[model samples]
Target chain A: MKILAIISEFNPFHNGHKYLLERAKELSDCDAVLCIMSGGFTQRGDMCIMDKYTRAKHAVSGGADCVIQLPAPFAVAPAEIFAKGAIKILLSIPEVSALAFGCESGDEYEFFKAAELFIDESDNFKTIINKKLSEGESYIKSYAEAFEACGGNRDIVTNPNNILGFEYCKAILRAGADIDILPVKRVGAGFGDGELKDNYSSASAIRNNLTDIRISDNIPPYVYNDLKYSADLRGFHSFLRYSLFRAEPKDMQRIIGCGEGLENKLKSLENNNIEKIIENATTKRYSSSRIKRILCANALGLYADDTQNFLGADLYIKPLAVKKTRANEILAALSKSVYPVITDANGKGLSAEGEQCFDKDRYEFAVYNHINGTDKKDYMVLV
Target chain B: MKILAIISEFNPFHNGHKYLLERAKELSDCDAVLCIMSGGFTQRGDMCIMDKYTRAKHAVSGGADCVIQLPAPFAVAPAEIFAKGAIKILLSIPEVSALAFGCESGDEYEFFKAAELFIDESDNFKTIINKKLSEGESYIKSYAEAFEACGGNRDIVTNPNNILGFEYCKAILRAGADIDILPVKRVGAGFGDGELKDNYSSASAIRNNLTDIRISDNIPPYVYNDLKYSADLRGFHSFLRYSLFRAEPKDMQRIIGCGEGLENKLKSLENNNIEKIIENATTKRYSSSRIKRILCANALGLYADDTQNFLGADLYIKPLAVKKTRANEILAALSKSVYPVITDANGKGLSAEGEQCFDKDRYEFAVYNHINGTDKKDYMVLV
Candidate 1:
C-alpha cells in the first residue's frame, strides 16, 4: 500500500502533467499516485483556468489515483509557504512513502544540498541575503545570489520548478518527514513557455490559447469540455478593483504579503486594466508574482494572522476526486492518517484549526462559483 | 439673490423631475434653482443609472442652476439621514432661502405637523413604535402605524415623497436653519410607479424601460444619450457577490446597516443571484429596501463610525455642474457658505472632516468607473 505524492497546480491537467504523473509512478515504484493540487488559485496568484473539482476529475482520468485540494491560502502563496503546506499534508498520511515533483534539474543531490543550506540558515548566508535585500533586490534574486555565494548552483536555485522542488525538500526536512524524494524531468516546453510545443504544451500556453482548436490536442477530452466555461484573472478585474477601492490602507495592511507601505502603493494604482495595474505596482523588491499574490489575497480578504494560524495548525486531508477502482485502497490508506480526513464539504468533525482552513477554502470556492454563475457543489468526483 | 434648494436623486432627470423643478421655482418665486443630488448611489441603495456628472449635466439642462453632489454615505441612506445631509449642505449657503420638494399631499401644514411630532419624539409615540417593532414590524411600518395612532394621516406618512418631505422639514427644524419650506404637487405618475404615463414618468419607470424608445418621450434627449451607456445594479452583481463572499461576520457587522446579527444572516446566504439573495434575506424586520441599502453599504465597505462622523461634521459644497448662464451667480452665492466649497476634484484646502468624506466619494466613483471601463473626469459639467 505504497503511495507516491506529487505537488502540483494541475491548472488544466494537460499532457505534460500526465507525463510527469506516469513517470513519477514508474520511478517511485508506487502502488498509487496521490496529487496535492492547488484548489481555486495557482501559486502565481491567478484563478485556475478551470475549477478545482473539474481539474481533479481530469487528473484522475489522466492517471492519478486521487487528487487532494491544497487550500487557497497556501495555493495562492509564495513557493516556501506552498511547499510547506503540501509537505505537511503528505507527511500526515502514514502510507505516503515517497514525494515526487517535476523539475528542470533532475539532480536530487543538488536539491538536498540547497535545501540543507536554506534549512540551517547560517549566520553568514543570512547576512549576505539581508544585505542584498537591503539593496532592494527581489527575494528570489537575493536568495539565488546568496546560494551561489555559498557554493551552490545559482541556476538550480533560480529555475522556477527547481526552486519549488528544493522548497519541498526543505519543508520535508523541517517537518522530520520519513519519505523518499523522486524528481521527474519536465519535458517539452519550459515552465514559463507560452506556446504549444508538440503534445506537451505548458498550462499557460493552453490557457492563453484556450479557445484555439489546437488546445484539444494538448488536454484530455473531459478537460477540454470543462474548459468551455472556464474563468481567468481578467474576468475578475472588476471584483479586484472593487476590493482594492473599498479597502482602506489599514485594512490592506492586514492582508498577507501586503507589507512595508505596499497597501498605499496598491491603493494608488489606477483601477483600469488589471494587467496595467499589476505592471505599475511591480517594483525591484516586489516581483510581479509577489504583487499578484498580494492582490489575490486582498480580493479574497485573506488576513495575515489567519494564514499564519493555518500554517501553524495541522492540515486536514480533503480529497477532491478519486479513481473508482482505487477509491477503496486510497480511503483505507487515508484512514491511518494522523490528521483528519474530511469526506464531506460541510466539514463535520473538524478541529477548530482545521475548521478555520476549511471555511476559507469554502469561501474561496464560493467566490469562484459566484463569478462563473454555477452552483457546482463540492462533491467528490469519481472517475 | 434668493436660491430655491431641492434635494433629489434624479437617477435620470426625467419629465417628472423637470416638472417638479419648474413648479418648485414657481411656488418659491426664487431667482435660481439649486439641486443637491445623490452622487454615485441613490437612497434605495442602488448605483445611479448614470454617472453623477452626466446626471448633473442633465439636471442643469432641465432647470437646475447648480447641482451639488451628495456624498455616498448620506446618498445611500435612510430618508431621515438623506434629508439631514442635504439640508446641512443647503443651510451652509447664505443665499438658499427656500427648500422645495415634490409631494403627493402638497400640504405644507401637514408636513410641518408631522415634522414637529417626529422632532419631539413623545413618550407615547415612542412606546407605540417600540411595541410595533418588538412585534416584528419593519421600521417604516411601525412608524406609519404610530403616526396614525397619534392623530396623523397614515397615507401622508406612508407616501414616499411625503415621508421625505416631512423628513426634510424635521432636519431643517433640528438645524435651526432660516429657510422656508415649499411643497410642490406631484403630477402624471406616482413616486413608485414603474410605467411611463404621459410626459411625466418616474425615474424608476424610465430606468426599467431604458432601452425602450418610449423612454425618450419621458426623459430629455441628452439623458437618452447618456442612457445608451448607463449602468444598473445588475451590472454590479459580481462586485457585490465577491464582497459578501470575502467578508467575515465581524467585517459585515461593521457595515453601517448590518446590525443585530444581520451580518450573520447575510453571510449565511447562498451566493447566487443578487436579487435572489436579497429576496431570501428579507424578513418582517428588514424590508427589501433596507436589505438593499445594507448590501450596497457592505459592497462599498461603508463603516458605521465613518458614516456617523460624516453626519456629525459639516458637509462641503461640491458642485458637480452649473448652468453656464448662472455660473457666476452660483459661484458667488456658494462663496458665502459656512462649509468649504470644493471646486477641484483633488480636494485641496479641505478640512480633515471634509477630506474623509471626499476620499470616500472618490473611491465610490472609482469603483463605478472601473465597472463601466470609462475614465470620465469629474470636471464641472457646464450646460
Candidate 2:
C-alpha cells in the first residue's frame, strides 16, 4: 500500500490544502494519501476554526484518503517539535513510502540541504546563534541570522511553510527514515496573508472572512457549513485569562515552552484582551507565536516532562476520519504498522504510554468543546 | 467605641441585608455598624452577584458604617471555616465589641448552647456522626442527626442561618474572643427562598430576578443599577470548565475542600454544563454546597495548605469600603487594632503571611474581572 503521508493543520481545509493533497498524490503516484493533521489546535498556537473530526471529514471530502490526529502536545507547538512529532508518526507506518508537505519553495533538495546545515552545527554556528540569542533575538530570528552567516538561504528559515518543510526534512534525516520527500509548492495567498485572493486563499484569509460570503468560494461546501460556528482565540480569552490568573509562576513554569521567566511575564500581564496580552508578552526573545503556544499549552495543561515523555514514547495512530470506500484497506494497513492504531475512543487496546499520549488529544478536544459549548463526541468521520 | 461587626455575604445588599444591618445596630446600640463581608464569593460556593467593591459600596449605602473583606479562602469556604475566619477578623479589631449575625432563631443563648454541644463532643456523639457519615449522609445531615440523637435541637442544625449562627458561636468560643454575640432575627424570605417578598427578599431571590422590575424594590437604587452588570457562576462557567479540564486529579485534590476522592469524581465528569457537573458530583456524602465550594476553590487555585496557613495566620483588616461620614473614625480605630489594616492594594506594610492572604483576594478579584471582561480596580468604596 503505497501511502503518501502529509502533515497539515488544515484549520478549515481550504482550497490551498485541497490543491496540496491532490498535487501530492499525483506527484508521488501513491495508492492513498494519509494526513497527519493537528487536532483542536494549530501549530501557530490557535484553535482550529472547526473541530478536528469535522475538519477531518472535510479533509476526506476535499482529497485525502485518511486523516489521523497530531495530538495537542505537538500540534500546539513550535515548528521544530510539530514537524518532528508528525514526521515520527508517519515514519512509524512502515508502508508510508513518501512524506508530502506544502512549502513556498518547491525544491526538496534545498530543504534537505538546509536541514543538513542545521543538523551538522559547527562551533562557529553554535557561538553565533548563542550570541544572537543572548542579544534577545527570537529563536527563529537567531536561527535565521545564524543560517545566513553560515552561507545558508535565509528564506528557507524565514518563510513559514519553508521553515516547516525544512524541519520535516531535518526530522526525517535525523531519524534516517526511508520515506521520500515530496514538496508541493503552495499556490495561493501566502501562509500569513489575511486578505482573500481569487479561488485560492490562505487559511488565515478564510478564517478572517469566515462570516463573509466571499469565503464560501475558498473552502469546501462542508467546511463552509461548519465554519459558521468556528472557534478562535478571542472566544477563549476568558479561559486563558482565568488560567493565567490562577496559575502561579511556578505552576506555569511546568508548561512546555514556558521558561526563562516567561511564566512571570505572562502572570504580570494585566490586559483583558487576549490579543493585547499576547502583544504585551511578546518580545524580541519571545515571539508572539511562542507566547501563543505557551498560552495554548498552559490551557491544555501540557507539562514539559509529560510532553517530553510523549515525544520519547512510541507513536500511536489515531485516525480522526477515513474515506468510507477505503476505510477497511486503511485500517488493515494501519493495523500491520509498527505503531498501534487506536480505533476506539476509550483507547481500548492502547499501551499505557500510548493511552497517555491519546489522553492529551482527548483533553484538548474536551477544552475545545467546553469553549464552544458543544458536546461533540470524538468519532472517526466517514465520508 | 461599641462597634457591632456583622458577618454577611451581602451578595447584592438586598433589602433583607439592609434590614438586618439596621436592626442589628438598633438592637446592639453600637456606636457604628461594621460589616465583615465575603469578597467576590459567598459561603454557598458561588461567585458574589457583584464585585466586592461594588457590594461594599452598596453595603455602605444600605447603612454599614464600615466594610472589611473576608478573603476568598474563607469567603468561598464551608460554614465552619467561613465563620471562624470572619470571627477572627472581627476579633482582631479592638473596637468591635460585638459580633452580630442574622439568624432564624435570633436567640443568642440558644446558639451558644448549640455551639457548646458541638464543641463538647462526646464518644456517643462521635460514633453516631461517624456511623451516619459511613452510611452516606452529608456532613450537615450527619451532624444534625448526631445532634438530635444527643438531645440537641436539630432545627438549629438544619436552618441555614441557625447553622451559621451556631458556627459563629463556636468560632467565638474556640478563639476565646471577648466580643459579644448579637443574633438578629431574619425577616421576609428565607435564606434559600427563590421568590421575592413585599420589599425584603433573600439575596438568592434578588439574583434570580435581577432583570425583573420587581427586584428594583428589593434592592437599593444604586444596587439595582449595579445589578444590571452583575457577575454570577453562569458567567464563570467557561473558566470553571477550563479549570477542571486543565487540572489533574492530584491538582484538584490540592484544592481546598476537594477531598475524599471528590477530585476524581469531578475529573471523571464528562459534562460541559457547570451545574450538571456539580449535580453529578454531589452525592449523599457530598452536598451540592460542598461541591460548589470545591469548584470555586479549584477556580481560584486555593490550595489546602495555603488556606490552612491563611486561617491560622494573623488577620488583615482590608477595608473594601467605609461610610464617608465615619471613615476617619473607623480608620483611626482600625489602625490601632491588633491586625494590620491594609489600605494599599499592593499589600505594602503587610507581613509575609498577610500579603499571601491579600494576594489570594487580589487573584480572586482578577478572576472575577476576567470573567466579566471588566478592568475594575480594587479600591475602598466610600459613600
Candidate 3:
C-alpha cells in the first residue's frame, strides 16, 4: 500500500481543505491519508478559530483516514523547526511511503533544487547571507540577496508555496527520509488576498467570510451548518490581542522566536497599535514570518519553550465518521496494524498515559472550546 | 446651577457617546450632568461590553459630572420597566430639574403624546395588541397596530428614539415626577446599521471597527488608545457562554421575564449561534429585548426574578472624574443633596451587594473588553 502523510493546521476544516484531501489522495494514490495537524495555536498566533478535535473530526469527515497532533512547540515554531518536527514523526513510520503538501509553485523539481541549496548551506552562500544580514535587512530579504549574490535564482523564495515546500524537502533530506515529497499546486485562492473565488479559497478569506451568515453557503455541507452555528455564536479572534498583552513579560519571552529583549519591547508596546506592537518587538535578525509566529504563539498560549517533550511517531487514527462495518473491520485490523490505534479517547476520563498520548489534541480542543464558548467536552467524543 | 439627569447605559463609553454627553450639556445648559447608567445588563439581553463603573468613569472623563448605577433588574427589564426604574431614581433627587435624552426623530412632542396615550391605557389596547400578535407579525408590528387602533399615531412608535423617548416619558408620568423631559436630536450615526460611518457610530460599529487597526481614526483619542492596549490582555468573555449553558435549566427559568418555556429553548441552543440562540428564544409576547436582559443577567450571576426589590437606589453620586479641584465642588453639593450619598461600597469583595453593583458593571466591561480586548484595570476608574 502506498501510504501518505499530510500535515496541516486545519484550524477549522472547510471545503477547500476537503478538496486538498481529495487531490492528495488522487496525486499520491495512497491507501490511506494521515494528517498531522497543529494543536491550540496556529502559525500566525491566532487561536484555531475552532478547537482541534473539531477540526480533526472535520478532517475525518472531509476524508482523512486518521489524525494525530503536531506537538505545540513545533506547531508554532519557525518554519524550519516546524518542518523538522513534522517530518521526523512521519518518517518514523517505515510504512509511510509519501508526504504530500500544498504549495504556491507546484513544481516539485524546482522546489527540491531550492531545498538542496538551502540545506547544503554552501560556504560562499553562507558568507553572502551573513554580509547581507549585517546591513539590517530581514532574513527573507537577506536570503534573497545572498541567493542572488551566490549566482543562484532567488525568485523561488518569494513564492509562498516555494518557501514552505523548500523547507519540507530540506527537513526530509536532513532526516534522511526515503519518503517522497509530493508538492501539489495550491488550487483556487492566494494567501493574503481578500477575495474568494472558485474552488480555491485562502484560509484568511474563509475566516473573514465567517463573520456574516450569508457566507456560510460557500463552506462544505458537513462543516457549513456547524461553521455557521459557531460563527453566529461568538466573535472571531476577539481576545487575541488581549491574550498577548496580558502575558507576563517572562511568559512572552518563552514564546517561539521571541528572543530575550523582545519581551521588553512587547511589554512597552502594551499600549500601542497592533502594527507598532509587531514592529517594535521584532528584530532585523529575525524574519517577519518568525515574528508573526511568535506573536501568534503568544496570543494562542503556545509557548514553544515550555513544550519540549514530543509524542512518539505512532499513528493514532481517530475515526470521525465510519460505516459500521468499516469501523468493525478497522477495529479488527488494529491488533495487526503497525501502530497503536486511538479509536476512542479511552472512554470519557483521560488516563495519564492516555492524556500523554493525546495532550496536544486535548489542548487544541480546549482552546477551541474557549474560543467558541463551548464546554471542552463538546470536542472530546467521536460518536 | 442647572443640573440635568441623563439616564444611560454608557456601556463601554466611547466617542459617539461623548458627543451625546457634550450635546446634552449644551442643550440643558447644565453645569452638573447626573448620569443614571445601567449596571449589569441592558434592555437588550447582551452584556454591556464593560462594567458600569468603568464605563461611568469613561463617561465622567468624557463629560458627565456625577454617575449613579441603575439597578440590574430594572436595567435589563423591558423598556417600560427599565424607564420606570431610571425615572424613579432620577425623581428621588429634587435637584435633577431637566431630564435630557436623545431621540431619533428630533421630535419630543410626538413621543411624549404617544407615551401619555400608552400610559393611560385608555381603550383596551392589550386586546388589540394580542389580536395582532396572533397573526404572526413581529411584536413591533403588533405594537404599531395597537397604537393605531387606540387613536394614537403609529409613526411615533416606529422611530427607535421616539419609542425609547416615549417610554421614558411614560415612566416619568407613571411615577408622577415633577422633572421635565428634554429630548435632543440624535446626530452623526444610527444604531444597528451593521456598518461603520461618520463620527456618529453605533456601539456595534465602534466595536467592529476596533477589530481592524485601520479604523482607529474614527475613535476618540483616549478611547482608541485605551482599547488598543486592552485587546492584548485576555479573552474577557471566553468562559461566559459556557458558564451560562452549563447552569441548571431550572436556574435559567428563574431569570426575570424568562417565560413560556424560553429556558428550554435556551437549553437546546447550548452550542448554537449567539444571535440565533437569542432570536429563537424570543417570543412575540416577550420581546427579544426583554429576553436579552434575562440572558445577560444569567451571565452576570444575577438570580432569576429578583425584580421586585428596588434595591433602595443605593449610592446617589459616584465621582467619575474629580478634575482635582472640581471634586471638592461636587462633594460640597452632594453633602447637601437630598438623596443618600454613597462614597464607598459596603462589602469587601463581589458580595451579594457588591455583585449586584459590580456584575452589571462587569457585564458592560465584558462587552467592551470583548471588542477592545483591554485588561480589566485599563478602564478608567471612578473616584
Candidate 4:
C-alpha cells in the first residue's frame, strides 16, 4: 500500500506529465500514485487550457490512481506559497510516504542540501537576497544569486523545476514532515520550451501549438480529445483588463504581489490591454508571471488577507477525479483524512476563508466550461 | 440666456431622441439646450449601444447646446435614484431654469398631481403598496395599484415614460427646486418596442434589428457609421453568468435588489446562462428587468452599501459632449456649481463615496470599451 504523492497542474496532461507519473512509481516503488492538481488557475496566473475535471481524468487515464485539487489559492500563488501548500497536503495524507516530482536534477540529495540553507531564513540570507534585488535582478534571479552567495549550488537554481523542488524540500524540512522527497530527472521538453519536441513535449509547448493534428503525438488519446476544446483567453482578457484599470493603488496594495510601489506603477499605466498592462507593471524586482498573478487575483477579488491563513498548511482536500476501481479507496481515505474532504465543487464544510478561495477557483472553472461549451458530465476519461 | 436641462441616455440618438430635444426647446422656449446624459451603463443596466461621446455629439448636432454625462451610479440606478440624481445636478447650475423630459402624456399638471401623491411616502401609502405587493404583484404593478388606491390616476404609471416622468417631478418636489417641469409627448415608437418604426423606432428596436440598412432610417448618418463594429453579447454573458453562480446567497444579499430571499433563489439556480438565471430569479413579485439589473450590479461588484451614500444627491457633474459655441458657457456654469465638475472619466476631486461610485461606473465603462474595440477618442459625437 505504498502511495506516492505527485503534485502537478497537468494543464493538458502532455507526454512529459505521463513520463513523470511513470517515473514516480518506478523510482518510489509506490503501488498507488495520487496527484494534487491545480484546478482552474496555474502558478503562472493564466488559466489552465482545460478544466480540472478533464485534466484530472487525463491523469487517471495516463497512470495515476487518484487526483485531488490543490485548492486555487496556492494553485495560482507564487512558487514559495505553492510549494508550501502542496507539501503540506502531501504530508497530511498519512498514506503518502513520499512526494514525487519532476526536476532537472535526478539526485534527491542535491535539493535537500540546498533546502537546508534556504530554510534557515536568517537575516544573513535576507541581506543577500536584498542586495541582489537592489542590483535590479528579478525575484527568481535574486533568490538564485542569494543562494550562490551563501555557498550553495548556483546551477541547480537555474532550472525552474529544480528551483521548485528545492522550495518543496525546504517546506518539508521547515515543517519537520515525515514525507521523503523523490526527484525524477525530466526526460525531454525542457521547462519554458514553447516548441514541439520528439515524444515528451513541454506542457507549454503543447499548449502554445495545440491543434488536433499536432497534439496526438504529445498527449494520450483521451487527453488529445480533451484538447479539442479550450476556453477563449481573448474574451477573458477583457474582464481582466477592466479589473486591472478598475483597481486603485490602495486596492492593488491589498492584493498579493502588488505591494511595495507596484501599485504606483500600475495606476500610471495608460493601456488597457492585458499584455501591455502586464508589461508596464513588470519591473526588475517583479516577474511578468508574478504581475499576472496579482492582476488575476485582483480581477477575481482575491485579496491578500484571504490567503494569509492558508499559507502555512492545507485547509481542505478536494477530490477532482479518480479511476473507477480506485474511487472507493480514495473516498474512504479522504473520509479518514485530517482536513475536510470536498467531493463536489460546491466546497461544502470549508472554512469561510477556504470557501472564498474555492469559490474563486470554481468561478474560474465555470468560465472555462462556458468558453469550451462543455460541462462536467463529459469530464470522465477512461483508460 | 435661459438654459433648458434635458435628462437622457441617448443610447443611439435615434429620431425619437431628436424629437424630444426639439420638443423640449419648442415648449421651454430656452436659448440653449443642455443634456445631462447617462454614461456607459443606462438606467436599464445595459451597456449603451455606442459610447456616450458619440451619443452626446448627436444630441449637440440635433439640438442640444451642450451634453454632459449623468455619471455611472445615477445612470444605472433605479428610476427614483436616476431622477433624483439628474435633477440634483440640474438644480446645482444657476442658469439651468427648466428640467424637460419626454413622456406619453403631454400634460404637465397630470405629472405634478402624481408627483405630489408619490412624494408623500406616507405610512398609509406604503401600507397600500405592501397590500398590493402581498398579492405577489410586480413592483411596477404594486406602485400602479397603490397610486389608484390612494385616489391618484392609475393611468399615469401605465406608460414607462409617464411613470419615470412622475418620478422626476416627485424628485424635484422633494428637493424643493425652483426648476419648472417641461413634459413633451412621446411622438413615435414606445418604450421597450423592439421593431423598426417609421423614422422613430425605439432604441431597443434599432439595437435588436441592427443591420446597416435597417439602422440608417432610424438614426443619423454619423450614428449609423458608429454601428459598423459591434461586440456580441455572448462575451459579457459569460462574465455575468460566472459571477451569478460564483456568489453565495449571503454575498448576493450585499448587492442592491438581491435582498429579501432573491439571493437564495439566485443560489438555488443550476443554470449558467444569463436568461436562464434571470428566469429562475424572477417571480410575480420580481420583474425580469429588475432581476437583470441586480445580476448586472452583482457581476460588476456594485454592492448595496455603495449606493447608500449617492442616494441623497448628485456627487459630480461630468461633461460628455459640448457644442463648439456652448463649451465655454457650460464650463463657466459648472465652475460656479456646488460639487466638483469632473471633465474626465478619471473622476478627480470626488468625495470618497463619490469615488467608489465613479470607479464602479468607469470599470463597467471600460468593459464596454474592451467589448466594442473602441476608445474614448471615438466617443466625441461631433456636431
TM-scores for every candidate against the unseen true structure: 0.79, 0.80, 0.51, 0.79
Worst 10 residues of 4 chain A by lDDT: A374-383
Tens digits of lDDT, candidate 4, A1-383: 56789889987898888888887888886778889998777888887788788788889989998888886777778888888888877777777778888887636777887888776766877898898889888777888778777777765677888888888888899889877888888888888888888688888888888763766888888888766567667755755655665577788898878788887777565245678778877876788989888877766666667667776433777777888887777667766667787766666787776677677667666655554445654232333
DockQ of 1: 0.28
iRMS, candidate 3, in Å: value is: 6.0
Q: Of the candidates numbered 2 and 3, which has the greater lDDT value? A: 2
C-alpha local distance difference test of each model: 0.83, 0.83, 0.63, 0.76
What is candidate 2's lDDT per residue for B249-310, written digit by digit as tens? 88888876686788888877734578889889888778898888888788787877887898
Q: Taking the tens digit of each residue's C-alpha lDDT, what string does model 4 give over B259-290?
A: 88888787666344677777877787788888
Candidate 3 at residue A114, lDDT? 75
Q: What is the C-alpha DockQ of each candidate?
A: 0.28, 0.27, 0.07, 0.14
Say which docking band candidate 2 falls in: acceptable
Q: Which digits, one per residue and each the tens of the lDDT, describe model 1 over residues B85-158?
A: 88888888989999988888847777877888888879999999999999999888899899878877776778
Task: Return the clash pairs for model 4, or none.
Answer: B53-B379, B57-B381
Q: For residue A87, give model 1's deviation from the true position in Å.
A: 3.0
**Model 1 over residues A1-383: C-alpha lDDT tens digits?**
99999998988889889999888877887899999998887788788878888888899998999999888888877888889888888888989999888889747777888888877878889888999999999888898889888877776788887888889989988888788898889988888799876688999899888879988888878888887778745546666676676678897898767878889988777455578778989887778988888877877767778778988887688999999988888988987887777866898777798898899888788778766667778878888
Question: What are the per-residue Cα lDDT tens digits for candidate 3 across A1-383?
Answer: 45678888875676667777888888886777777788656666556655666677778777876666666667777777777777766665665778888777646666677777777789988888888789887778899887766555576677765676678888887777787878777667766556765545677777777765544544666666667445222243333444554568888877766756876766666544456666776665665556667666765556654454443334343333333323454344333444444545452343453355466555455545545656655222342
